[model samples]
Target chain A: MDFFQTIIALLESTIRLSVPLIFAALAGLYTERAGVFDIGLEGKMLGAAFAAGAVAAVTGSVFIGLLAAILISVLLSLVHGYASITQRGSQIVSGVAINFIVFGSTVILGEAWFRQGGRTPALSGDARFQTWDLPFADAVKDVPFIGPIYANLLSGHFLLTYLAFALVPISWWVLYRTRFGLRLRAVGENPGAVDTAGISVIWLRYRAVICCGILCGFAGAYLSLAMNAGFVKGMTAGKGYIALAALIFAKWRPVNIMLACLLFGFLDALAIRLQGNPLPLIGQVPVQLMQALPYILTVILLAGFIGKAIPPKAGGIPYVKER
Target chain B: MSNPYAKLPNWAEYGLIPLVNLVVAFLVAGLVVLLVGENPLNAAYHMVNGAFGRGEYIGFTLYYATTFIFTGLSVAVAFHAGLFNIGSEGQAYIGGIGVALACLWLDRTMPWFVVFPLAIIGSAAFGAMWAFLPGWLQAKRGSHIVITTIMFNFIASSLMVYLLTRVMKPLGSMATQTRTFEAGGQLPKLDWLLSIFGLNIGNAPFNVSFLLALLAAFGVWVLIWRTRFGYELRTMGHSPSAARYAGISETRITIIVMMISGGLAGMMALNPIMGEQFRMQLDFVQGAGFVGIAVALMGRSHPAGIIPAAILFGMLYQGGAEIAFEMPAISRDMIVIIQGLVILFAGALENMFRPAISRAFASFGQRSAAVQTKGA
Candidate 1:
């Protein structure tokens, strides 16, 4: 392949890899903005992935599977909200519990239902979301730069990928321009102030968490129904945590989150490409080092070696009403 | 104002609450088992039989418990200082590298006792160093310890993978593991000790590391509850301003506490590397580091609490294996769900039923007082 084609292909792969991260980071953005630290994004995603795959396989309807995924993800989010908000429990502990529960239950349920080593039966046809080719793709195939960009880079992605990208601007507008956004930010900063302002802090936080759940549901569905054929155990891997890191790296902003996710996605793509390949100067780079790069970068970014990351003041604290 | 429940009894406060939570978790787990078309009672019996029905089972239970004790103590120490050190898993992973390096260099020449001590120190030092950066960042750069530690875990996993596959794997070997250590480098098993008592433990991997775990627990008790540093750590956790007022340097305490915690986590390598596997390999730490978090929380960060909690989890692990072996219906993943439930009830929803229980006790006390007044 030529240089431009190679770049386009890399970019395409980067976009594909980052779609889930984008969705998860946005999910985290909504919750964390409302003072709820959600480390269970991974758990919700895993649950949704399994639900989507299993349901889609059984029903032969991808849309219904997507709905199932969203429902399950939303239920888990409500559990987190109830534990952290109503119960006034430790949010981190709640998040960790969710991850553990989802991680284990998915495998158990998968094994019992499918008997396929904790994997759902592979879906075909309507059960899986197929990539769509954009209009005029063949007509523009003869064009130079624009043709490759349109045909290879922009087109042929699953519907969820487009929605993921579209959600970024929507998230930014919702977070920055909407009335609900203002209240959500204020609650995260100081629930006492939000409460005094006559806003229901609990309800606002719950709303944000629900939004987080929906987005995570989309991310999970994309993984199982779009990217892969079926749900496998631990399939979400550490993407949820990586999304958390990306959220922090972006300082909890929506547009910045896109940039962070893309950066991580690029690194992940590079890591995959670098495996078993020899570099010019370093000779054959160890695959482990490449795999470790993203985490190393996250640690560096977190350490403020580049810049400081200040979380919401009341992020982890459970709000209590005063008499 | 005196709280009635607070005045009930120390045992109720410390012991009863945890026990009730554990029972609730198990009940929920039983329901899950029942949903899977298995008899809960039979499953429980199997778990019990698998964990302690014989000497070998008991040995395996203790063997698992030994690792949990180290990692649990690692977390408990950090908890006392108001620090969440989630990198124990990573620290332990890197500590294995230290053990491997030491074994490679000295195992062929040095005596077992000398090599063992050196390997322990090497492991602890490496683990401490792995934690030091995050601790420093949290103290000086205002970074969140949880994020940094979690990131460190991924890094450690990758680092170990590289070391095992590319760097340390013996030449001509296809496996991703270091060469096995000489017999002298391996820790002595507890078979002889059990034999002295006219008992045989079969091929269970329980070793002198269990003794090390006990000693470490006692050491932690002394360090956390008795020493001046312990006072400072508790003060800092309870009230940072008070600790500052008492001339405690937050930065110093953070670094020191993390180093100590990491050291404890690092010592966990002795069980797996020296006692069981006798070689460096990928994922030896498994999820023991994460389990430590559950252990510390359930144990209320007390050594006394952690020991039993560790043993209970150890039973869950060993018994879960046996159950999977005997009953294919109960997959190994089911045990993970049970563990998660325990974590959910005991850690996250710890105080879910506290108010109700306390209220009940308060009502009972009020009625008894009224009866006494009527009698008077």
Candidate 2:
């Protein structure tokens, strides 16, 4: 592909690559806005993927596995909430503990049950997220300037890919239009005020985290079940972290978060495509540099070029009743 | 609602909440071990034995601990300045690449003694540079170091992987590694002692890297306590606004500490690269920089406390591999389980021990009086 085509290809691929991240980033937003820092997004996502993949592989039921994965992940999220939010423990410390517990347990169980080294067996067609082709997608795929791009790019994708995009609008509405949304935001930015106003801090934060956990579960399931068809060791591989970057980059706005995830996803997709690809003068750029793109951009964004975005005032701080 | 009439336990004054947490963790860890069918005491015994039973094992454990010292010091130094450094992994990576490049460039012309120092300094400089960017961002724009540093680590690791795989591919073997360093680039050994025992220190990769690690720890301790800069760092860490009112520049301390922290992280390469490895292979730091967080936390950011913590962690790491090797199917993973448990328990100690200290400090009268007071 020429430079123009590659750029176009990059944009298209970014959207595709960013689907899972969009889910995760928005998931992070919900929790962070509710005054809880969900550092265990990585662990939650990983655990969910393993559950989903394992169930899918065994039962040949993709939806069931995904649901089970979401449920299990929700439980883990609640545990995290209990530790960090309810118990008023250290957020980072609690996150680190949860990650380890999930990581090691997953590997241990994987070995004992699957006889595989920290990976689940891949699913067959019946068990996997079956890709659906949009009608007329192929006919216009090769039409001309925009035809091939749209057809080749946007036509075929897993069902979750569409859901990830749809979630942007849904998240915006849920965060802004609803009573729960106001309470959630109020709890995060000023929990004391919310508490004085007669709202329960723990319950609101708990509800928000549970929502985040469910979203992260879907994102995790999409990762292995949709993309790779199985869960591998360290499968999340810090994607949850990147989702956090996207979350911060978006300034906790659902719409902005979608853009940030897409940007990162684009960088990631470009990097993957660049691997072993012949370049005129660059002698094929190392994909590692490509992989590093999102982080570099994150660093740039976080360093304050972006306009002021205040985090929820009460975020990550445990409320202790000083009677 | 009428509970205000009751006295606050004098012990409850401090963060007594987190103290009880530690005891619960120990119980959890012990129970988990029991479920796995190993006696917790025997497991603890094996842990102790694996780390220090043999001098050579101590050597192995210390070698691992040496790298952690740099990483832990990196974390502690930043924490002292009130910056969370999740980017030590990247800084260490940069330092690794810096050392490799230095060896590649200077080893041919410079003597072993000269080249070795240059490599160490070069690594530190690279590590410092790593912190500089994030520090600049933090100071200039008030960015969050926790998120930024974590992001930097990813970029650094990915870049390293790409560099090794494609750009810096060694001449002979087409592996994801660079060429081995020349002999002169290696750190000078305490070969005299090993020669006295007539043991093959040559066969074993143990060297004077551990001593350097200890010296760095001492230097960091002195730097943190005895210096004006350290005072500022500690002040800022406690409260940035208070430090600001005290005329201490918070930004200056953040930048300085981040740079210093990164440099310390940079020195971590001395343990592996200059010792037995003599080259940067994949996973050169071997996640030690990441584990250093746990080490730093468990040690409560004290240089002296970190020594034991780092060594303890190193023991589990070595023991894990050994068990996995010996048992075949039994699992070396127990070591990681224990390590994770240790971190969890240590964090809980803050909740566990502080209440006792608080109770010991407060009088019963004052505790009871404070309890009855209503509005601020």
Give the alpha carbon lDDT tens digit for every residue of A1-323 in model 1: 49787689889999999999999999999999999999899999999999999999999999999999999999999999999988877788788888988998898778877899999999999999999999998889779889989988899999999999999999999988999998998999999999998989999999999999999999999999999998999999999999999999999999999999999999888778777778778798777777777778877878787787789888988888874
Of candidate 1 chain B, the 10-residue stretch with the lowest lDDT total is: B1-10
Off by over 4 Å in 2: A1-13, A133-155, A278-284, A306-309, A321-323, B1-46, B105-112, B166-173, B188-204, B330-339, B352-376
Residues B1-376, model 1: lDDT tens digits: 1222244467876798888889998998888787777898998999999998888888898899999999999999999998988899999998887788888889889877888888889889998999999999899888999889988999999888877877899999998888898976788888887677666789899998899899999999999889999999999998899999989999999999999999999989989998899898789998899889888988989999999999998998899888888878787777678777777888878888788878888899999999999999
**Candidate whose DockQ is highest:** 1
Report the C-alpha lDDT of model 2 over B1-376, residue by residue, as the tens digit. Answer: 1222234454453224323544455567557566545566666566577656665665667677778888988999988887878788889988987788888887777777777778788899999998898898889887777777888888788878878876787766777887878876677666565557663343445667677788889998999999988898999888888999999987788888999999999988877887877778888876777678778876678888788778767877765665555444336556545555555555522444444555554566667778779433
Clash list (residue pairs), candidate 1: none
Runs in model 1 deviating more than 4 A are B1-8, B192-198
What DockQ do you compute for every candidate structure?
A: 0.67, 0.43
